[model samples]
Target: MVTRKGEQTKALILEKASKLFNSQGYRASSISDIMHETGLRKGGIYNHFENKEEIMLSAFSFSIDTMSHFFSEAMAGKQGCMERLLSIISVFEGIAERELFPGGCPIMNAAIEADDADLLLQEKVREAMDGLLGMVRNLVQEGIKKGEVKQGVDPEFVATVFISTLEGALALSKLYKNQEYMKRAVHHLRSFLAQNCA
Candidate 1:
């Protein structure tokens, strides 16, 4: 069993590593980078993790969890599909405005970098993406059942468009060192949701 201090150390390591991996390409980030970021010696880090791959994946999961926490906070007490969806978009906007991840959305960052990365890493990205999509799809279905969304709207398509547009806009916003790109996407999304889902 892990001791309390051990658990704390592991969490610290994951937190630092997640930021490092997101800022630097995961594959490009070496064990030395993680050690440097966490201020932990090789033995210190290796004590909690079996290998670099373990650390990498764990860190990736940590990043996703961070984003999920924000989503949960934003959507709390919200009712109906449009409100919930707008809350989600607001969360994404906050990501850019607050500079939540200096390297952009970790899932998109890792997935884009995973083209030449390990197959396991690629598969992990797919699983993470699928989970995000599933959440949005479920929200759309619930909205449909509640008679908020237009009849026969496809959950799969809504999830894809919502995520894809927001992610692309985020990247552009980051690249240009401006928030207007994200604001524009959010505006367009709000209009689309109001028309189609209201």
Candidate 2:
């Protein structure tokens, strides 16, 4: 069983670390910075995670879990695989518009910041991204099975486009600090889906 205080501490650390990692990038953020953000000492921080890499891994996990939960919740009452796919896409679009992450999508940020530099981080990013795209691909495949999506549609290709479009929107939004670009990208993406999807 987990103690309430211990769980609280862990949650607090993860929250601060996620935000700091998002804003500062993994290369720039330090354990000390995390400590400062959480108002915890070195010992307190280290007590939960062994090193910065460990914290990074945990933060990545936290982000994936959070996003997955959001998607699941958003699609709870919705029916049809196409609608489900749109709901998933819409949730991410909402996140982009809200600038949910100070750094952008955690997986995307990790891919750009650490994928080439750190193989471990790269693997983590790859796994997380693959998992998300896999969800989309499965949804699309289900739609095809139900005769909802276009016949002969390549689920993987569709998933890739969806992922790419969202990531591109995020990059643009962060660059311009404007949701308009993201909104437009999302609009175009949705239009493409509506036009192409059967």
Candidate 3:
């Protein structure tokens, strides 16, 4: 019974922690802040998580799950691979332009801020990126089969370009706190896709 309760507490911590990290960033959000937000004592927090890094990992996983669900749903009911690809872009463009995260893309934000100094965070970021790239790669391969994308077009290459542009757009938008940069980035991405597909 106690063990189950402990697990429940840990899960609760992760849910709240993920939201806090997403909104305030990993650096700006402290354990004390989490404690305050969850109304859980420090002892209660430390009982489950060893440190902030562990919480961060949990938050990242949470973000991945959330993001994957959104993309997967968007991909559903789409016929051509190219259509699925466009839908993916549409999701990102809508989210980015609308300020979905209020802190921007959590994975991109974490990658830029924590990649160099934090190895664990970097690994999580890499995993998150691979997840994103995998979606694009799968769609591109499908497009090739349907003659939507060019035959010689490399799925991996296209995925990489797509991921890079989206991340760059998020970074630039965050830096200037301006949505125009993100809009321009997505426009360029759409143009690139059009050129490749045509």
Best by lDDT: 1
Predicted candidate 3 versus true structure: per-residue lDDT over 139-166, tens digit per residue: 8888888888888999999899988888
Per-residue lDDT of 93-136 in model 1, one digit per residue for the tens? 87787557778888899888877548888888999899888988
Who is ahead in TM-score, 1 or 2? 1
- Provide the lowest-lDDT 10-residue window in model 1: 94-103
Using TM-score, give the best candidate's number: 1
TM-score of each: 0.94, 0.92, 0.86
Q: Which ten residues in a row have the lowest lDDT in candidate 3?
A: 94-103
TM-score, cand. 1 vs. native: 0.94
State the C-alpha lDDT per candidate.
0.89, 0.84, 0.82
Cand. 1 Cα-lDDT: 0.89
Candidate 2 lDDT over residue span 1-198, tens digit each? 668997899999998888888778888998889989999999988877888899998987888787788888889998887688778777777777654556678888888887566888889889999998999899889888888888888999989988898888888888988888778877887787787667
- In angstroms, the error of model 1 at 82 is 0.8
